[model samples]
Target chain A: MIRTKDIFKSFDEKEVLKGITTEFYKGKTNLIIGRSGAGKTVLLKLLVGLLQPTSGEVWYDDTNFFSLNKKEVRAIRMQVGMLFQASALFDSMTVEENIRFPLDMFTNMTYKEKRKQVDSCLERVSLSGVNDSFPSEISGGMQKRVGIARAIVLNPRYLFCDEPNSGLDPKTSIVIDELILDITKEKNITTVINTHDMNSVMEIGENIILLYQGEIAWRGHRGEVLESDNEILQDFIFASPFLQRLRESALGK
Target chain B: MFLKNILYHFGRYVMMLGTAISRPEKVSMYYKETMRQMNDIGIGSLFIVGLIAIFIGAVTAVQFSYQLDGTLVPVYYIGYVVRDMTIIELAPTFTCLVLAGKVGSNIASEIGGMRQKEHIDAMEIMGVNTAAYLIMPKVIAALVVIPMLVAVGAFISIIGGYLASVPTGVMADADYIKGLRSFFDPFNVTMMFIKAVVFAFILTTVSCYQGYHVRGGSIELGQASTNAVVFSDILILVADYLLAVILTS
Candidate 1:
């Protein structure tokens, strides 16, 4: 589990995250949803220690993340995995090499053992037999799967995804979403996703927080989204007339 | 404001060097990366270095021959001039300036692209000391190979002077060889190596600093790469002057 205490972030005196305190549970898909420029990305970066909070504490399990020394910070980082919006795979490496990178860097595993682990991860993401292909040769959806394979190759206790489903079609988006959900449950890792995808929110969102102009406008599970009467939440979820009609039908209005 | 910016970059560059030279996580992996960089920096640069070196020596011989025309100075002085100039001034300084344009810009663009693509952040999050993993090998490769390139350039330049002067009947082959052998100071060779090593370090580190701190999109990346080359050239020239003063004094 990860928790943030009054997390505040600023850049050049423009406060982006204003006192966000939240808890993301283990073994669940925790989503931070907001419109553009709503501080979702900033807050997510702060949570991952990529950016320091202007003032607050990020507690990874029981330890304060910022208080750790360099060596200790690296120790914590070894247990973290992140999937970038662009997948962030090393362009020169093949899929197998990309997935095997963390293991090669951090483990004493033999070539055969690393190969076996790579195969298992490829199979887990249903990406077998394309191990030798470079990321440029794969489709966007396939690249996301490869990204997930690389992320989980280390078996990290915490997983962070930044807009994983962006640039994919609906069908591929659902597939990627289900893959992330399955991995979270199977590994029981603390999974945090920053996205504005409503489909993702309705489907895999176990704990969701909505940010509006650097403040938490609303927080709830997906099942409560249609029932909630919060003005901002309704304005956001039912922005489209089609979704508004669907909400009316679901609520028996 | 300008001074503040310089101090900021200077402090940051020094700190970056500190992290970049830390203990390696794995000796074999570092070795593998170092070898790849050696191949890239050495083999990839041979053709350009040799091409410039030959022309540099040829031009120096031809120009100096023209200057010595109708004068009491011996024709053999053309060879001597080419030898001493190539060793003490032209080889390390000229060759490294060209390399600062070629290899330095390339290093900046490569690292900047990776930074924009979040590859550096990914490596950092994976517990890799990104400064060390990405930079140490490049620095090592440059330090080791650049001096070797300078030595090769010096030898080829002497041959180039011979080719231009002797083949055209400007001077006899024996005269050129004798000029090369005359007034040969070993300290000049030491100065050449000293300049090469210092120039190599400056180019690699300065280019890396420009790339590593790059933010924003493609436009910013382009500026970073340009700054890398420009700053490296400026710094290499400055270092050359300082080393000349310090060593020759």
Candidate 2:
């Protein structure tokens, strides 16, 4: 589990996250949902040590993340994997080489062993037989899957996904969400995702925290999201008239 | 304000080099990267370096031959002047300046693109020392290959001098060969290698620094590439003057 204590992050005089304290439980898909400028990205970066909090403590299962030295922080980071919004894969390397990168760097595994591990990861992501293709040669959805394959190749204890469904179609988005959810359950890892997709919020949001102007406005599971009395959540999530009308009909109003 | 900005960038550059020189996570990975970089820096750049070097020698020989016309100085001095000038100043300085324009901007753009694409961030999150992995190979490759290029340039430059003067009938072939053998100083060759090594270090590090710290979008990336070449050229010139003074003194 990952926990933040009074995490306050500011840029110059502009405060982004104000005293955000929350827990992301292990083996659960913890989603941070918010509108634009709602500090979702900043909060996620803070949890992963990409950005330092203005003043707070981040505990990664009793290990104080901020208190550790550079080497110690790197040790912690070894067990952490992230899927960027753009799926930051190396352009010059093939999918197989990209997946094998971490293993080649960190492990003494032989070439045959690393190749087996890479193939297994590609198989797990249902991306078999495209190992020699570059990231540009594949579709965006395939690239994201390759990104996931690379991320989980190391079998991290913590998996962070930033906007995993940004440019993907709704059906593909659901597939990606299910993949992440399945991986989380399979590994029992602490998973934190920052997303704006309402479908993701309703479907895979096992533990959801709604951030409004940096502070936590509402906290609930998907089951409770529609019934909650939080005005900000309602306005933000049901922004479109079509969605609001669907919500009203569902609530039988 | 200007001084403060300079100091800030300088401090960051120094700190980055400090991080870059740290012990590698995997020596084999670094070795692989270094070999790839060597091929790119050395073999890939061969045509341009050789082209520029030949012209530099030919121009020096022709100009010096004209100046020595009807003068008390021996016609053979044209060859001597071309040989010494190419080794002492022209080859190392000119070849590196051209490379600062070509390779320096390329390094900056490659790295800056990676930064914009969040590739560096991904590597960092993977517990890889992004600085060491990205930078050490390029620097090491430059240090090894650039001096060899300068040596090749110097040798080609002398041949160029011979081609221009001997073929044009401006000076006798025997006089040119005699001039080439006259007053050879081993220390001057040492000075040339020193300049090549120093210039190589400056260009690669300065370019890497520009690319690594780049922020913002495409416009910022273009600016970083430009700055890489500009800063590298300026530093190379300054270092040239300093080395000239130090080595001769």
Candidate 3:
């Protein structure tokens, strides 16, 4: 499990995350959902050590993340994997090479062994073919799948996805979400996702935190989402009239 | 404010170099990258360096020949002057200035594009030393190949001088050969290599620094690429002067 304690992050007198304390459980899809400027990205970055907290403690299991030196932090980061919003694949490398990058950098595996590992990761992501294709040659959805394949290639203990569904169609988004869910369950990894997609929040939000104006407005699972009386959560989840009507009709109101 | 900005960048640049020189996570990966960079910065640059060098030598020979027409200096002195000038100053300084525009901007754009695309962050998240992986190979490749390029440019320039003057009846072939053999100072070649090495370091590091710290959209990326070339050129010129003073004295 990953835990944050009173995490406060500020940039030049402008505070982005105001005392965020939360637990991201193992083997569950923990979602941080909020509107733009709601500190979702900042909170995610702080969790990943991309940005430091102003004052707080991040516990990766029992170890204080901030207290570790650079080498020690890198040791922790080796067991961490991230899937970026834009699927940050190396443009120059083939899909196979991209997946094998972490292995090549960290392991003493032979060429054939690395290729086998990469093939397995590609298969796990349901991307069996197109190994030699460049990132630009594939569609955005395929790139995201490739990104997931690369992320899980190392079999990290902690997985972070930043806006995994952005720019993807709803159907493809569901596929990506299901893939992440399966990986989390299979590996028992701590999965944390930052997203604004309401579909994602409703579909696979095993544990959810709603950030509003740099604070957690509400916290619950998807089942509790419909019945929650939190005003901020209600306003965000049902912001669109279309969604509001859909939610009302589903409730038989 | 200006002083603060300079100090800030200077400090960051030093820190970046420090990080970049750390022990590699994977020696083979760095080796492969260094080889690729060597090809890119060396073989990719040969044609342009040769073309510019020939022109520089031809111009120097022709101008010196004209200047010598009404003077008491022998016609053979044109070859000697061209040889010394190309070896001591023109080849290293001029060649590096041109590469600061070519290879320097390319490095900046490549790294800056990676930054904008989140590739560096991805690597960092993977526990790879992004600074070392990205910057070190390029610096090493430049250090090794650029001096060789300067030497080749110096040779091509001497040939260029001979072709321009000897073929046009401006001077005899033997006189030019005599001039070429006139004064051979081994230290001047050492100075040329020294300048080449120093200039190469400045251009590569400055360009890498610009790209590594880039933090915005296409406009800012373009600005970073431009700043890479501009800063490298200015620093190369400054280093050239300093080296000439220190080495010659």
Of the two candidates 2 and 3, the one with more favorable DockQ, higher being better, is 3
Binned by DockQ into CAPRI classes (incorrect, acceptable, medium, high), candidate 2 is: high
Candidate 1's displacement at residue B39, Å, is: 1.0
Which residue window of length 10 is worst by lDDT in model 3 chain A?
A225-234
lDDT per residue as tens, model 2, A42-109: 99889888899999999999999999998898899899999999999999999999999999899999
What TM-score would you give candidate 1 relative to the actual structure? 0.99
True interface contacts reproduced, per candidate: 0.70, 0.72, 0.78
| Model 3 lDDT per residue over B134-225, tens place | 99999999999999999999999999999999999999999999999998898999999999999999999999999999998999999999
Model 1 chain A, TM-score vs. native: 0.98
CA lDDT of A224 in candidate 2?
A: 93
**lDDT (0 to 1) per candidate:** 0.93, 0.95, 0.95
- Candidate 1 lDDT over A1-253, as tens digits, reads 9999999888998999999999999999999999989999998888888899999999999999999987788889999999999899999999999999899888999999999999999999999999999999999999999999999999999999999999999999999999999999999999999998889999999999999999999999999998999988888778999999999998899
Sort every candidate by DockQ, greatest first.
3, 1, 2
Query: Number of backbone collisions per candidate, in order?
Result: 0, 0, 0
Alpha-carbon deviation at B75 in model 3, angstroms = 1.3
Interface RMSD (one decimal) of model 2: 0.6
CA lDDT, candidate 2, residue B4? 100
